[model samples]
Target: MKHVTYADKALFLDDDSADWLMEYARALGSATMTDTVTLRGIGMDGNEVEATFLLNHSTELITQTTQSGLQGPKNDEAVGYMQEQTRLILTPPPARSVDDPLEIS
Candidate 1:
């Protein structure tokens, strides 16, 4: 058996940037490594509300193991390790530096 894991991250944004970020997150939702978004509302408590996102990711693995290794599919162990090593943070999710060539604006 193979186990699946999920993870989430949150980012804060101002009024204008929040909208843009939300839209961007939605667009990337269908990708293999995109942020699953849950837009939070602003509060009057002087604390900035955060835009919570579940990075639709896989990491944890479930499998039967013996002395040698996993006793499942041939590539299960490799895939599981790869999944764990894969970064939950998505490409083009946010934070483009000034020197980033991919930045359009």
Candidate 2:
């Protein structure tokens, strides 16, 4: 177990804080990356939520997440994930040309 002390609030944190948290987690015997944290709670509307932080190991910012039981944010998240999947796939039809009135497809 490693023991170290560091400040919790810093406008801009440096390597010392990162090493400190990693060392502390290791001291606690954690086996995963230190930047990942899971938050679980019931919001004011009484819905339970589980949000996991997806972070850049170096930046420690939540770049993305897997949240449960939250519809609005999930729907918003889907737009970016599903854009490529929502395309129309059409078999080549007769008389279709690259300069057609509508899109070639």
Candidate 3:
């Protein structure tokens, strides 16, 4: 199975920048990928947050297994493994309110 891991830290930015990161994550989740991808989770600091994504192996096979329960879908497992590791370092958080600034900000 293919594996992809990444991390982000955006605690230095102001509230606006943090919000943008959240939007960016949403966009990324829907973004296209040749392999099966899963959103692990995100860490938040006031308006800032860190996100992670994992690309697993036999994504198409897994999807087919989940949907059809049939094997041998052209054996594109290696292709999935060749996927690039992706990470995004965000600056200038989005426009949003940070509740309990003392804890996160």
Candidate 4:
């Protein structure tokens, strides 16, 4: 059966402070390009202090045709797998102090 898995990494920025969230998004876009990953979306709240960026990709699936081609069970299995993976990855991390400077190695 042919299976497709879509995956995305998202970052949430708290904009209640003086930080340059747009600049951060631009930097992230450049770094993602270097790593060959596409940035899916960038959004900011009405106040411009809260922002979100989505980075996304999908898995390649290969399938062999049987007499029936693809079956319902196969499709359901693939959907379940992708859903579980997405749930695990999309859970937000614990909140941190936005006033702290980001550490770079």
Which of the numbered candidates is closest to the native, going by highest lDDT?
1
Tens-place lDDT digits, model 4, residues 78-104: 334334444444453567799988779
Tens digits of per-residue lDDT for model 3 on 19-64? Answer: 2333433434445432333222222322323233333322111110
Q: Tens-digit lDDT track for model 2 on 1-105?
A: 111122321122123332333333343233333334333333334454444433232433211223333332122232222232222112224776777688556
Cα lDDT for residue 51, candidate 1:
36
* Local accuracy by lDDT, each model: 0.34, 0.31, 0.28, 0.29
Instruction: Please report, as a residue range, the 10-residue window in candidate 3 with the lowest summed lDDT.
Output: 57-66
**TM-score of predicted structure 3:** 0.23
Clashes of 2: 0
Identify the leading candidate in terms of TM-score.
Answer: 1
Task: Please identify model 4 stretches exceeding 4 Å from their true place.
Answer: 1-74, 92-105
lDDT of 1 by residue, 1-105 (tens): 122112332222333333333334433444545443333333333343433444333322122212322222233333233333332323434666888787367
Error of 1 at 21 (Å): 1.9
Cα error, candidate 3, residue 13 (Å): 1.5
The full ranking of all candidates by lDDT, starting with the best, is: 1, 2, 4, 3
Estimate the TM-score of every prediction.
0.26, 0.19, 0.23, 0.21
* lDDT score, candidate 3, position 55: 31
Off by over 4 Å in 1: 1-13, 35-44, 48-52, 55-105
**Model 3 alpha-carbon drift over 4 Å, by segment:** 1-10, 33-105
Ranking by TM-score: 1, 3, 4, 2
